[model samples]
Target: MKKKPTITAQTKQNLIDAFWELYCAKRIEKITIKEITTRAGYNRSTFYEYFTDVYDVLEQMENTLISKLKELPMQQLSSPGDPFPFEALVSMYSHHSKYLVVLLGDHGDPAFQGKVKASMKPMIKEILVSQGAKDGFELDYTLEYALSAMIGILSYWFNQEKGPSIENLMELITELSSEGVMRKLIG
Candidate 1:
């Protein structure tokens, strides 16, 4: 029989879940380790064994999200008409709605937000470059514009109590990316 690992998987998940619950209610700086452990029903020793501090918990969470995003088939998202990739993105974000609201909202970590944008930059560039090639326009400015707009939109959507449905948000993004402001303004 395999030796049982200490700090079992469920325990780690519970710690993360508890930390998220508390972090959502108040800023990370305002939260205490005691509170986290209390909520998680774990003692300080156990918490210490797994993490260095509240920030470590946040870092762990960020790493998990980054890993998930890295696993996405970004190269497969060749066009705006590709609903599969958009669906996956929206679903992944929606699955972590509460955590996203806390992490991407007003009191969120600026560094983490920057990391999120940086991680997506390459994939965004790839998609936009492909689209721009067909549209016959300079994409340098457009790529930055699209990325900033997306972050703003995502921040807004996550903050809402009952935001637009995932499908609705995805549709709006697809429409905006496909039509663009210049075309809409010209028409």
Candidate 2:
């Protein structure tokens, strides 16, 4: 009798790590399953046992990140007079900066960013409404602006070698977010 393929969490993580490494080194189109398995120290059968293709692996990675972000204490930021929950936010990104840098790099996936925005918008909207933003065009504009600026700042931080300290980054986010860019510009 033939043995069934046993997929373990370790093996899946190895594959993900290996895939990220290869993806960092080259474009996704240039990466092959053979390379992924070889780097992961697994064979073809083992690689296929968990993921159907490279895109599937990428999607899984993106979903895993999204899930982590969703689990953060977003409700804490909703209250009035609360300090900006910067530590929690920055730590989560810095901890996973390796995979994130790759995704936000020159060869990054725009689709992944889109998915991230979609997943995060609702939480941000709730936070804003709780902080007294009215449900109107202003709310929509604020959501759009906040999400875009966040993605841009994160991408910059991940890519730069001497980016601001996490605390500084948090301060920058808080200041700019509270003080509108136009206000700073017009001053």
Candidate 3:
């Protein structure tokens, strides 16, 4: 679908950027749309044009993140495989670690996390199918199961003060899944 040129996109993006800046200097609960628009140099209507509230903006941010991560060709990924993309993703996350920490902090919505999980199901199924797991192999059930597992691991990595390096984590996931159940369908 071709996106028509409009102020909505710009306003939404500006709001998101504003939220990021404010989120750094203040807590998410303390922030307001007034502050977001002011920081973003937009007006109230512009802010309304984008998101309903601070949490709404946060939802948009999470969706953006999931989409970004989803862009990665993550199916069939294994140890001793490509390093560049995984490294790039980790680097990006590390760069924005503060943003993520604040947005997904203790008070964040479980439903927001659920949205991310729901969103990634199709992508996970794609990876599974490409790796020789049938496209319809228990479909939604397996997709959700695998995606939930991946999300759980990623959340642990994201929350920790120190954890396995991305390279290590990538290899870890591959080893855990690839050789055990994942190899069964292919062989």
Candidate 4:
């Protein structure tokens, strides 16, 4: 996204480091490009050379963080069932809670959230299909409800920094799925 050659490894690292420090301490709105540059020891022009805004910096931070967080599939997730997905999502959030709270704080943009949800949706569909779910279940309300619940739990847990452990979360997910998620679509 950088149009200028002014971007450098050191500059990128400085900006990320500055953003992380600010995000961890408080909400994203309280932080500013000026503060980031000040902390990173870079000026306005230097900051512009890399990211467009504080939000952009956070966006990139999140993109990078999610990629890193998703690297561990099983260790990072509860079972794939809807009810317990939150636990797995929450554990990953806990792994990167500071980054997430700031990235998704009140000041966070909705488009980024959409991007995140879009990425996860197909995976859910795939899980459903693989489990012998009929085509009807792919867009069924139960799936949607389950997804929303999981996302909600993830948001709450990340923001509050409180919730069940990953193991418990997985158990909950399996229990919820057994209730209906594993049922035949043809039935």
Error of model 2, residue 68, in angstroms: 0.4
* TM-score of each prediction: 0.77, 0.85, 0.63, 0.66
Error of 1 at 121 (Å): 1.0
- Return whichever of 2 and 4 wins on TM-score: 2
Model 2: which ten-residue window has the lowest total lDDT? 178-187
**lDDT: which is higher, 1 or 4?**
1
Q: Which number leads on lDDT?
A: 2
Instruction: Estimate, for each residue in 1-187, the C-alpha lDDT of model 3 and write its tens digit.
Output: 7556676677677788889888767667899888988889988887886678888887778877777766665553432222123444455556666655555456555565577666656665555555566655565555566555655666678998789878899788767656643454333
In model 4, which residue pairs have backbone atoms overlapping below 3 Å? Answer: 84-173
lDDT of 4: 0.64
Candidate 3 TM-score versus the reference: 0.63
lDDT of 4 by residue, 1-187 (tens): 7544455877798888998888777677899988999999989998997799888887887687657544535323434333234545665777776656655556555455555555565565566566556657445655556655555556665566467766776677666556665453213
The alpha-carbon lDDT assigned to residue 124 of candidate 3 equals: 53
TM-score-based ranking: 2, 1, 4, 3
Tens digit of lDDT per residue, candidate 2, span 1-187? 6553464878888998899888888888999999999999999899998899999999999999999988878777544533234566677778888887778667888787778778777876676566665667766665666666787788788788898787788788877865773232222
* Candidates 1 and 3 compared by TM-score, better number: 1
